[model samples]
Target: MRRSLIALSLAIVASTSLTAAARADIKSPVVIATEGAYAPWNLTDSAGKIVGFEPELIDYICKRAKLECTIVAQDWDGMIPGLIAGKSDVIMDAISITPEREQIIAFSNPYARTKAGFLTARDGKFAKADGTGSTLVTTPTLNNAADTLKSLRAKLSGASIGIQTGTVYAEFIEKNFGDIATIREYRTNDERNLDLENGRLDLAFEDTVVLMPTVEKANGALEFTGPAFGGTLFDAGSGFGFRKGDDELKAAFNAGIAAALADGTIKALGEKWLKADVSP
Candidate 1:
């Protein structure tokens, strides 16, 4: 009986140690990856720190979720591959939730929503095209606006368009205007904007909230053309990306997002940074 009691106590201690180690593992800090180049979403500040709407939002989300997290800058092209390889755990770079992306990775419930539009030189011919001044939903298909699409095609036909690669805006432009226009993909928005500014490209397409700053700064040199587009195709909103198997991480972020939205934290931050209520 004495030997058996000693063995039982040893077993209990071993089990307790194992449980403590597991808890410690759970406490490890989550690593979040962002493009750090997209302004008003995520950008690398002059101090070499990543700062912007998404960063601030994530800070609140992490705290609410009781998640210890570290935000890191990453190239836009490598976000998914890095997440898959375990170099990062979460992606918060304004990734639009799309059916195509859903097949490869999981997305937390959307936190913010915005529309896409086209920008061109103020004096460019494309600038003369008419805009609907209202959003057109393009989820599932563009059938709702067949005539509008046709008109836009005729207006923008043969124009050289620039867009950041790996973005939903790029996919939209390619699918809608690929046949009618010359589409050029850049690794970053600044690169594409530079080409457009230098007359190397006729137009650029991107998130309207993102392009608005460029237009305002252009001081009459650039302007938005055509109506902004929404719906799942263009504005399903932005969400945090994770490996499909990381359900725990996704759940934590979903909860955090929900809490933030409920308390108006998201709306307040959106107004401060984007000048609009982007909360979904």
Candidate 2:
């Protein structure tokens, strides 16, 4: 009996040590990066703290995944490079998952989907264009897409269109309307928005989620014009960006995001921030 009792105690000690080791292994923090300039998705407060939809969503995700996480601000252009350089473990910047990007990095299951459209002054010529206030899911082989593009080209011909540099919006414009419209690229959305507001730009192409708040803040000065576009150039919504080989971290984020979407957490957050349900 004495021998059996000693053996049982030894077993208990080993089990406890193993459990502690597992717990320790699970407690390492993940560093997440975001472009703090994108409002409604991720933005910096006056105090320089990151806040907004993506940040709130990530907080819930971390809790659900039991992950210790820290979020850092990064320039939009440097997000991918920083991840490659090991500066961050995840990026939650409303990055659209496109084939071109898929070649370079992995992505979490998409958490939200939105569309791109034009924001112009209320009295702008394009305000009442044929497809205004409608959503268009465009594809390369779609007849309606070709028709819509042709109409938009004619309507916006010779107009100065502003877009942020190095974005899919630039790609779409240059591919479809480059010969028809004068394209101007800015390094930041704020710069393009300023140009649009000052009447230097006849139109500005941007994500509708971002444009909604801008229009509200502009009162009646600005409005979304032309058809809001999705698919193809816009890709299939936004997901968390990860390095190409980080399968473990990608799985963790996917599980957390799936739970959030299942529980309506993402939709609730979207409505609170964007005044729309952008959950995917």
Candidate 3:
């Protein structure tokens, strides 16, 4: 009876040790969410796998940060809510790091910088607008921003403009041009692109990185017009977004992004995918 009791006690100790060991091995992997419809940033391939510039950059970031990560596709409108609800551990959808967004969620250091511009039909009325191909930086705080927006509004007045919902571009349009121009919001950039292609939209505002490739593929059907706006609404550029309290994850990503930027990994990826060096 004594021997049996001793044996049972030993067995229980061993089982407890095994349980602890198993718990130690159970490390959580970071799950990244992105909108697969934003080409050059991210997009679903023919095989239904998410691929693009952001994916490649995130792979490098995860490797540098020693994180096991899985990238998943989510709609643009759901990205922030999904992160807040714990549905995703991170967001790598080229989300601009804007002040308005900062009030809701935290952001890592910017990974890339690009300007926003308008895309219009090649022979459209606004194709030769005064600001075509010019780079303009404006922010709500700038003293001259009101005048600039007034001029821009006049250029786009009475026109139909399409923008992706839940983006800074949408906000910019609503604030500056909504009163004069007809604003159409779509769920995805692809949808907006289709409407623009179908002649349903007079102009479309989007990242120049995204716009350039699309214009190239359009084969003269489309051309970039108006000033390329940066700063302010566009944020300090694009960054990885996390829940407001996830400081540890935010720090890890920021470090990894710094490393990637220092090593030129992001620049190479940006040039390869965006055809420009958009690394911040």
Best by lDDT: 1
TM-score per candidate, in order?
A: 0.88, 0.88, 0.87
User: How far out, in Å, is residue 257 in model 2?
Assistant: 0.7
Write down the worst ten-residue block by lDDT for model 1. 1-10
Report the lDDT tens digits of candidate 3 across residue range 138-250: 76565646666667777778999898877877887787788898999877778888888889889998888887767887899998877788766557888998888787788
Instruction: For candidate 2, write residues 1-280 as lDDT tens digits.
Output: 0000111111111001111112133435577777788997887787777778988888777776667777776667777777777776787778878888888789999998888898889987778788888899866445568888878889999999998777877887888889998999887788888888888889999888887777887899998877888765467678998888788778878998899889999889999988889977
Tens-digit lDDT string for candidate 1 (14-71): 0011111122334456777777778888777776777789988888877666666777
Model 2 gets an lDDT of 0.76
Q: Candidate 2 — number of clashing residue pairs? A: 0
Higher lDDT: candidate 1 or 3? 1
- Residue clash pairs of candidate 2: none
| lDDT at 118, model 2 | 87
Return the lDDT, model 3, position 68. 69
Q: Candidate 2: worst 10 consecutive residues by lDDT?
A: 1-10
Alpha-carbon deviation at 205 in model 2, angstroms: 0.4
lDDT of 2 at 172: 79
Off by over 4 Å in 3: 1-27, 145-147
